[model samples]
Target: MLKIEDLHVAVDGAEILKGLTLEVPAGEVHAIMGPNGSGKSTLSHTIAGRDAYEVLSGGVTLDGDNLLALDPNERAAKGLFLSFQHPIEIPGVQTMNFIRTAMNAQRKARSEEEISAADFLKSIRAKAKLVGLNDAKIKRPFNVGFSGGEKKRMEMLQLVMFEPRFAIMDETDSGLDIDALKMVGDVVNELRDPSRGFLVITHYQRLLDYIKPDAVHVLADGRIVKSGGPELAAELERSGYDQFIEAA
Candidate 1:
């Protein structure tokens, strides 16, 4: 449901992503793996329309609509969600309120009715449980005092609640244990519809074991070096990224 064509990007006048391209169609999962500084995160940020990461050239589209032309908020409103590698800690903002506002924002943008408070709680409570989080965790300030794995769990909570048409998860498995990683897989599999797509950017193949991506891409030095099936992820784990790094 997302396409990137010969994408080029920069931030504050420095080049980052150079001629990168990939596609994640509906009902499929794609994993992007690479060493540090290969523009994995930049690709996600640029696709999400994050500020400062200017698209110097090329195009990104969500189901044929120009994604690069939209603002970050607009992209989000279009059912595009990016789960950051590091979730911020908003000490005073209740997690419940934050998610409710975001969900309502998307709904209002689409001319859908705002969820009733009772409905919001009911919906998110079910989603929260799906992500292995309890009601108390959802009641806390967003990510405040949460451990790394907990923050990742919180991100999954949002993913489940939002149920976006397309999601770009950046380093979502960074700190997750096997249980949390499986939670990620469960939520993804549960949301796997013919209208939903996912791009999972990660550094290791362990997460792939849980999600079973439809395709695997090796990104290095700002471009994709190899594209293969699930077997490629396993190959990389056995062979290492050293070859791709050199090729990049």
Candidate 2:
């Protein structure tokens, strides 16, 4: 389970996540909906242990392991993945090489044998197809010269390939079209299992139409102001976040 207990975080001396608390139990997918600057990305980055997102107080734990103490790479080795809202472009790194290196590094940290070249090739090709990415795209530099939708596809490809125990998708639906959104849902649903968990941070209800989160949370002023079943997303869509924002 991923649990947050009164987490207060600051970035560059300004607090973004203030006394936020939430839990994503294993086998569940939870969605977070909030207006801009509500600390949705802040929560994700803090969980992933990014630099300068200082944890002023509170705690975050994954299956009883204190996540606050671990570095970002250590967290990745422990099966935590964060799909960035804006996938950056690496000018010179080959896509396949970078992913393979990262996969092997995580395996090495876990004391597992590295995947052989042939096996890695086969797996990446299969997952690329699954996420609507083609062989040509995968052969290019990572996210370089790719459209926003293509970058999102690359993120989904990694999600499917890594099969992380817990995933925090920060507004992955931001720049995607209907087809790309459905592809994201398809990859997530295929990976859904009794042992994996997802924290999907999104602004729209359409993405939820495909993924169907078990719970929907309303975040305002860096805190979860309201939480409900999947229907809450629709309610938020109809009513908007004004009420929740005021309440918060």
The candidate scoring highest on TM-score is: 2
Worst lDDT window (10 residues) for model 1? 124-133
lDDT of 2 by residue, 83-158 (tens): 9999999989989999999999999999999999999999999989988889999999999999999999999988
What tens-digit string does per-residue lDDT give for candidate 1 at 145-203? 99999899899888888889999999999988899999998888888888899999999
Clashes of 1: 0
Worst 10 residues of 2 by lDDT: 154-163
Q: Candidate 2: misplaced stretches above 4 Å?
A: none
Q: Residue 64: error of model 1 in Å?
A: 0.7
Measured over all alpha carbons after superposition, the RMSD of each candidate to the real structure, in angstroms, is 1.0, 0.6
Model 1, TM vs. native = 0.97
Clashing pairs in 2: none
**C-alpha lDDT score of every prediction, in listed order:** 0.91, 0.94
Return the lDDT, model 2, position 238.
97
